[model samples]
Target chain A: MFLWIIQRDLLLAMRRRADVLTTLFFFIIVVSLFPLGVGPEMNMLRTMAPGVVWVAALLASMLSLGRMFSSDHADGTLEQMLLSPQSLSLLVLGKALAHWLVTGVPLVLMAPVLGIQYDLSTDALLVLTASLLLGTPVLSLIGAIGAALTLGLRGGGVLVSLLVLPLYIPVLIFGAGAVEASAAGLGAGAHMSLLGAFLLASLVLAPWTAAVSLRISME
Target chain B: MAINWFKYSSPASFYSLAGKMIPFFSVAAAVLFVVGLYIGFFVAPTDFQQGEAYRIIFIHVPAAWLSMFLYVIMAMWSGIGLAFNTRLSSMVATAIAPTGAMFTFLALWTGALWGKPMWGTWWVWDARLTSELILLFLYIGFMSLQAAIDDPRRADKAGAMIALVGVVNVPIIYFSVKWWNTLHQGASVSLTQSPKMASTMLTGMLIMSLACWMYAIAVILIRTRAIILERERHTVWVGQLQEATQ
Candidate 1:
């Protein structure tokens, strides 16, 4: 079921590759601006890279979060899913998994390339990728709950940020910390472990709440 | 005797009870604040390191404690409300947000004042301080989300989910920020320089925390009463009460 949902989402995304690429471009542009805003001093840019990349990813993912349920909710597919005998949590999981795959994986893939722009060492770039790879799932998972809750509301795009951004801070902290630690020659292992723990916790917990949120919003 | 827990779950019953309770807590909070301040300003020996500036601890620490405490409490109330579908519990959670936000602001402002004199900076990315700042953001997020949603019931459920999620992340954020801070700056903040707490200083802090607790109860009760009136306005009792007041 999960694989099917992910495949469907990917197929749909492929049909509208522009939207997916827009997200990637948004992230890339946001991260690139920092070097221009704060002069292209190699040392300073390298130091700032972790926070900049994490924050841009956060903002970029937030833009995409609105789409998580809005498309289905608008077309009435969400209501039908809620009414189905198949567990809503699994469906919710499938959707969240698809969101992570479509949005998060791309960001993870793109981050190492951006890291190199800031002159991140090979080790730092590797850690940044590992961190986001673990951390972004947590974002999609938690964002799913926010997306589910805010479905069909006016100005929901902003509302999803208001709901999810604070929740994103932990992931940001650990994610960025891992990269920064690696840049400083400290092992990123502990921070990566923590990020992985967050991923696991959010995985177990978020879908159930998101399912409940879908029911409430639909009602 | 089996206790009927559901009795006060009704807003009307809870309303009258909270009204009766507010005054007692208000008086207690006022008295404790006076006593706490007296001890903090006069009785507690001036810090050898920070001198009079350290007295901000009385307000800062209590506000900081209340800020974190209230989020957990708010989350618990929200979780209970969501799980049990109890309207009053959710209302209590909503009422707690503004107060929690106020405490978070108070903590930040006081930390700024304290930090200025002690650390010679208005703000530093100290682990605890940054975590508190994010906490302020969380409270704002909770209140904003509630305000954005029109249906009060839906708002309540949504707010509850955010609060529950926030509770889970708050610790992770704090620990990670702490790790990040320590990795960057070794022990720079005055609070880290550990002045041995004189007994009188501890007493003042305890008193202030209690005062904040009482103050929180009184304010929340009053706010909850207002919430009950707004929500239950369509009901006969509220309508008749409005008529009687006029």
Candidate 2:
């Protein structure tokens, strides 16, 4: 059931390529804008890379969060899913997983490329990629809760950002810390381990919260 | 005889109970604030280190503590409301948010004032300050979510979800503080930890915290009364009260 939902979401997402592409471009533009705002110093960019990329990634994922439910919600498929006998939490988990695949995975794969723009070394780039890989799922999972909560609300996209961004802080800390530690030649072992623990914990908690919110929003 | 718990869960009964409680808390808060401020300004000797400027800690620490404390309380009210489908609890959660946000902003402002002389900068992204700033953002988020929804009950449940998510992530603030310090310890910046204070200073700070607690309760009660009136305006008791007041 879970894999089917993931595949279904992926198929639906594949048809709406512009939305996925927009998230990527928004991330790139936002990230590139930082260097322009801060000046062209490679050393400064290197130092700021972890924070910049993570924040941009966070914002980009927020863009895709609205798409998580809006389409199915509009089409009434969400009501069907809610009415189904299958566990809604599992369904929410599947949607979050699919969201990460469509939006988050690309960001992870593309992060090293951005890291290069910031003059990050190969080692630091690897750490950046690893951190995003672990961290972005946490973002998607947590974000699903926000997305579900705000579904059909008048305040729209920016409102979800207002609600969800604060919850992203710990993930931001460890994810950026891991990359920053690597950039400084320190082992990222502790930060990565902590990020993993956070991811696992959110994995259990976020979907249930999201599922409950979906039910409430549907009402 | 068994206590009738559900009676107070009703808006009309809670309204009268809250009305009765408000003046007592208001008086207590006023008295405590005066006592706390006197001890803070007079009884506590000038700090050996930062001097009079460190007196900002009296206000800053309590506001900071209340900001964190109220978020937890708000979340608990929201969680209980969500789980039990209780309207009054949700109203309390909603009422607590603005006051909590005020204290968070107060904490940040007061901290900045204190930080200037001690750190030679208004802000340094210190772990505590940064986390408190994020907390302000969290409170804003919760309130924003509540305001955006059209249906009150839907808003309550949706906000409850964020509140619960926030509760789960509350520990993140502590972890982020630890991680931030470790990540920055190697930097040349020597943002000093606050020095150990005199006993009088500690007493004053505690008293200030109590004052904040009383103030928050009084304010929340008053606000919750308004909320109850607005939400239950169509109820017979509220209508009768409105008629009597007019």
Candidate 3:
């Protein structure tokens, strides 16, 4: 059921490829703009790179969250899925994973390139990519709850940010912290471990919470 | 004597009960405020280090404690409302939010006041302050989510879900200092250890906390009564009560 939903969403996303690319472009542009805004000093840019990239990833992931279920909802497919005997949480999980695949993975792949733009050393770039790799799924997972809660509400785009951003702090802390720690010659292991913990815990918990939120929004 | 515990659980009953109870709590809160402040300012000895500026702890510590405490209580009320489909529980949760947010703002403001003289700055990105600011955001989110949904019941359930999800941050906020090395000091009044302050200072602080508690209850009960009236206005009893009052 999960794989089917992921495959189906992937095909749907393929049909509308611009939606995926928009998020990716937004991530790249936001990451690129930081060096310009904060002078092009290499050492300074290197120091700011991980945080800038991680924040852009957070925003890009959030920007695409509206598409997670609003399209299915508009077409009434969501209600049908809700009535399906298979667990709604599993379906929501699939949708969130699909979202991460569409939005999150691109940022993770693009981080090293963006990191190089900031003049991050090889090791720092690797840690930046690795941290986002471990962190962005948690963003997508937790964001599913916010997206579900604001599903049909007006001004939902702005409202979802207010609802979800505070919840994203721990991820932001540890995600950006991992790179900063690695750059400081502190092994990124502890921060990576914490990010991995967030991933595992959110994986177990967020789908069920988002599933309940979907039911609330739908009903 | 057999007592019916659920008697006041209904919005209708609780409305009148809260109305009667408000004055008592308000009075107690007023008295405590007077007494707590008296002791806080005049009785509690000045810190040898901080001198008079340390007195803000009476207000700051209590407000900070209440802000976090109210979030937990609000989430619990929300969880109960979601689980049992109880209107009153949800109303109480709704009513508690503004008070919680108020205390959060108070905590932050007083922390700034206290920090300027002590930390030599109005603010720092210390873990405790950051988490408290997030706590404020959580309150705003809960209230805004509820306000956005026109249907009270849907709003209740939706707010409950967010509240429960946000509850995970509370422990993180409480432990943020211990978890991270930051400018914020470790907890001075933890239950596991004897307080590391003068006895009079401790008394003043606890009394101020109790004053804040009484004030919060009075305000929340008053707000809950208003919420009850708003939600239950279509019912017969509320109309009759309205007629009686007029």
Clashing pairs in 3: none
Best by DockQ: 3
Across B1-246, the per-residue lDDT of candidate 1 in tens digits comes to 999989999998898899889999999999999999999988999889789998998998889778988999999999999999999999999999999999999988997998887788898776677777788888998898889889999999989988887886456434554555442223222455664578799889989999999999999999999999999988888776743358
Model 2: per-residue lDDT, tens digit, B55-100?
9989988887788889999999999999899999999999999999
CAPRI level of candidate 2:
high
1 against 3, candidate with superior TM-score: 3
TM-score of chain A of each: 0.98, 0.98, 0.99
User: Where in model 1 is the C-alpha error above 4 Å?
Assistant: B1-3, B169-196, B242-244
lDDT of 3 by residue, A1-219 (tens): 999999999999999999999999999999888877989898888888889999999999999999999999999999999999999999999999999999999999999998888888999989999999999999999999999999999888888999999999989999999999999999999999999999999999999999999999999
Please give the CA lDDT of all the candidate structures: 0.87, 0.88, 0.94
What candidate 3 gets wrong by more than 4 Å, as runs, is B242-245
| Candidate with the larger TM-score of 1 and 2 | 2
Question: How much of the true A–B contact set does each candidate keep?
Answer: 0.63, 1.00, 0.67
TM-scores for every candidate against the unseen true structure? 0.93, 0.94, 0.98
Clashing pairs for predicted structure model 1, backbone only = none
Q: Which sequence of candidate numbers ranks them by lDDT, best first?
A: 3, 2, 1
Whole-model lDDT, candidate 2? 0.88
Indicate the residue-level lDDT of A76 in model 2: 91
Local error of candidate 3 at residue A213 (angstroms): 0.7
